[model samples]
Target: MATVTFIPAPAPDHTASLRAAVRYGVLGLIVLAVVGSIVATLLAGMPGLYGALLGAAVGGGFILCTALGVLFTAKLPATTAGAVLLGTWLLKMILAITVLAILKPLDFYDKTALVLVIVLSLVIVLGAETYGVLGVKAPYVEPRAAGDAEPGEKDAQ
Candidate 1:
C-alpha cells in the first residue's frame, strides 16, 4: 500500500493584512459619503447651496470614526464588530427620536431630520460591518523549506 500525506492551506501574511486595512478604509469612506450627503440635504431644508458642504462634513466624520474604530479594534471577530455597529445604530436612533420628540413640543425640531439620522446611522453600521469582514486576517505559516538549502549554497552538503 502507498502512503499519502495532505498539505494544509498556507497562512495569511502582512500583505494580506495591509490589503484588508485599505479595503475596510475605503468601504468606511463610501458609507460616510452617502450618509453625509443625505443628512446635509435634510439640514439645508432644501437642495440648495449649503447642503453640499454639510453632507461632506457628515460623510467625512462618519468615515473617520469608522477608520479609527477599525484601527483600534482590528482583532475583533466579524460578529463582535457587527454587534458594535448595531449598538451604535441603536443609540443614534434613540437619541434622534428623543431629541425630535422633545423639540417637537416646542416647534423647534424638523421632522425630516429624524429620517436623515436613521439613514445615516444605518449606513455607518453597514459600513463598519463591511470593513470588519474585509479586515480579518487568518493565521500565518512558515515555508516548508526554510531550513533547507539548494546545491552549492552554504548549508548544502
Candidate 2:
C-alpha cells in the first residue's frame, strides 16, 4: 500500500493585498457607473445620474470600510483579530442596508439603474479581490526534489 499526503495551503499575505483589492474595486466601480449612465440614459432616462451617484456611494463606501478593517486588524492582538474582523463585517452590512433603505424610496432617480450598478459593483469588487489576492506569491510551498522521476516512469524505465 502507498501513502498519500497532501500539503497545506499558504498563510496570510501582505498589506499590498488590500491595495490591489481597493485599486481594482475602484476601477470596476467607475466603469460600472459610466456604462450604466449611458445605458440608463438611452433606455429609461429617469434621472439616472443621481441613481448612478447613489450606487457609486454604496460601492465606494463598502470598499473604504473593508480597507479600513483590513488595516485595523493587521495591527491588533492575535486573540482579538477574529472579533474585530467580524464586528467590522457586521457594521458594513448594516450600513449598506441602511443606505439602500434610505435611498430606494426617493423619487429623484431610477431605482433600476441604481440597483443594477450596486449589484454589479459588488460582483466586480468580489472578483477583483479574489483575483488580486490569488496573484500574491505563495512563499511557503517547498521546492520539488531535483531530477525526481515519477513512480510510474521509474517502473517503465
Candidate 3:
C-alpha cells in the first residue's frame, strides 16, 4: 500500500485581505498628514506662503516615511513592521520641523500662494499613491498539471 501525504492549501482570501489592509492603511496615513498640516497652519495664524511651505515639508516627509515603512515591512519580520514605521515617522517629523525652521529665513511667495502649493502637493502625492495601489496586479492564475495543454493550444501526440 502507498501512503499519500496531503498538503494544506493556502487560505482563499488571505492575500486579498493583506493587500486591502496595506492599501487602505497607506491611504489613510496620507490623508491624515494632509489634514494635520492644514489644521496646523490654520491654528498658527501664519501667512499663506508660510503655511504652504510648512505643509509641503510635512507632506513630503510623510510620503518618504511611508515608503520607508513599506520597504521595512516587506523586508523584516511581521513583528517588527509597526516599530519600524513608528521610528521612521518620528525621524521624518523631526527632519521636517528642522527644514521648516531653517527655511524661515528665506523669502518665498506670499501666504496664499504658499498655501495653495502645499495643498496641491498633498493632493498630488495622495493621487499618486492611490493610482499606484490600484495598479497592483493580483495573482489569479492557477498552475497547470504536467503534460496538460493550455487553453486554445493543441496537444502533441
TM-scores of all candidate predictions against the true structure: 0.37, 0.69, 0.48
Candidate 2 Cα misplacement greater than 4 A, ranges: 1-13, 138-157
The candidate scoring highest on TM-score is 2
| Candidate 3: residue pairs that collide | 48-111, 49-111
Candidate 3 residue 43 Cα shift, in angstroms, is 26
Per-residue lDDT of model 2, residues 37-131, tens digit only: 78877776757877776776687668657766776676678769778888888988999899878876678988877888777777776787767
Error of 1 at 37 (Å): 0.7
Q: Per-residue lDDT for 45-112 in model 1, tens only?
A: 54422333333344444444544554545567878877776676566557546754654555323334
Each candidate structure's count of clashing pairs: 0, 0, 2
Model 3, which residues run further than 4 Å from truth?
A: 1-58, 108-111, 139-157
Global Cα lDDT for candidate 1:
0.53
C-alpha displacement of 53 in model 3, angstroms?
9.2
Better of 1 and 2 by lDDT: 2
Regarding lDDT, does 1 or 3 come out ahead? 3
Taken over the whole model, the C-alpha lDDT of each candidate is 0.53, 0.73, 0.59
Selected candidate, larger TM-score, 1 vs 3 = 3
